[model samples]
Target chain A: MKISVQADAFDPGAELNAFSAGAAGAGAVVSFSGVVRDEGGRLSGISIEHYPAMTGKAIGAIAAEAVERWDLSDALVIHRHGDLAPGEVIMMVATAARHRAAAFAAAEFLMDYLKSRAPFWKKEYHADGAEWVAAKDSDEDALGRWAG
Target chain B: MKISVQADAFDPGAELNAFSAGAAGAGAVVSFSGVVRDEGGRLSGISIEHYPAMTGKAIGAIAAEAVERWDLSDALVIHRHGDLAPGEVIMMVATAARHRAAAFAAAEFLMDYLKSRAPFWKKEYHADGAEWVAAKDSDEDALGRWAG
Candidate 1:
């Protein structure tokens, strides 16, 4: 498993290739990428802040749980912070397992945790002003499916 | 939507990058890749055969259904035929949408259909002899979850 919280821009395609290569014995791989939407041209960009000391540890713990639960051969998570323009990739998760079901489930599990529980603050910029974004009700609801 | 039934080997990462670029307004992108498992060193390789006239059309119809059901911004399906070595990729499916739930669901739906219903024949090679592989009951059961 690998987790990284960084401000630099990275290529999702390259990262996926590297992760798949490292997953030696796996027969299935799944990946999810979250991008910043343009929001009908009203949005300019977004700035993200993180609790540096706790973010990585928190994500690592969740990723480890996913690996154990799904019996994954490998897993990877990368989240970007700082300023991000519309259409830029904000975060990504990848999982590898012997079966497609396990790989897909693990990837979805990681994404749910990240979207709802990860310690990241986002501020969106518009033409008039910028405002802090709040957690969406849909995101919280999405997390509930895995609670049991 | 794009569907290809071919014998050529293609890079999954490169394909993903191109698909994401074309997705334009999507906020979530999900991908699943199926690879040939080594089967504990007992397996040598496998050869896949398909009905050339129907394979492409069948895949295209399923992909179109997924896009409509999930309201996808884009979708892609690629399946390779001919001989494949252990650890080689057999197929891939990708979906892009405005939300993660739709993207993940559509990708999984496509995979379930491909595994159970796609018109592909498989023959596995062993040290002593080769045998035609049959569809797994588990794969068939997986398709039930998506039914109305």
Candidate 2:
């Protein structure tokens, strides 16, 4: 498993290729990329902040849980901080397993944890002003589906 | 939407990159890749045969349904035929949408359909002999999840 919390932008496809190459023995691979959306063209950009000290550790633990739960051959999470323009990639998760179901489940599990549990703050900037994004009840509900 | 049934070996990562790049403005993108598994090191390789005339049309119809159902910004499916070594990619599906749920669901839906309904025949080759692979009951169950 691999986790990276960085300000530098990265290519999702390139990262995917690297992960797939490292996970050669796995029979299935699934990936999710979260991009900064324009919100019906009303948004200009988004700014993300993270606790550098805790970010990697928190994400790593989540990834570990997914790997164990799904018996994954490998897993990866990459999250970017700092200002990001619309259409930019903000975060990504990838999972590999012996079957497609496991791979897809693990990827979704990681994404849910990342949205609700990971220590990240986001602010969206639009024509009017910038606003701090709040945790959506829907996101919380999404998290609930995975609860034991 | 794009669907290809080919004999040529294509790079999954490269294809993903191209698809992602073209699917700009979408907030979420999901992808799944199926690789040939060695199965306890007993399998030598796998051979896949397809009805070339109907394969593309059938897959394209499935993809169209997913796009409409999920309100996808884009979708892609690629399947390779002929002989494939263990660890070689057999097929891939990708979906882009405004949210992660739709993207993930569409990708999974496409995969379930491809596994159970696509016009492809698979035969696994082992040290002893080769066996024609049959559709799993699990695959049928998986397809049922998306029924109306």
Q: What lDDT score belongs to each candidate, Candidate 1 first?
A: 0.91, 0.91
TM-scores (chain A) of the candidates: 0.96, 0.97
- Judge candidate 1 at residue B125 and give its lDDT: 99
For residues A20-80, write the lDDT of model 1, one tens digit per residue. 8776589899999988889889899999999999999899999999999999999999999
Report how far off residue A89 is in candidate 1 (Å).
1.1
lDDT of model number 1: 0.91
What DockQ do the predictions score, one after another?
0.73, 0.69
Evaluate model 2 with DockQ and give the value.
0.69
Residues B1-148 of candidate 2 have per-residue lDDT tens digits of: 7788989888888888788777767889999988888776889999999998889888999999999999999999999999998878888899999889999999999999999888999999998998999889999999888989
Clash pairs detected, candidate 2: none
Cα lDDT tens digits, model 1, B11-125, are 8899888888876589999999887888888889999999998888888888999999999999999999999998788888999999999999999999999886789999999
Error of 1 at B37 (Å): 1.2
In DockQ terms, which candidate is top?
1
Candidate 2 similarity to native, TM-score: 0.97
Tell me the spans in candidate 1 whose CA falls farther than 4 Å from its real position: none
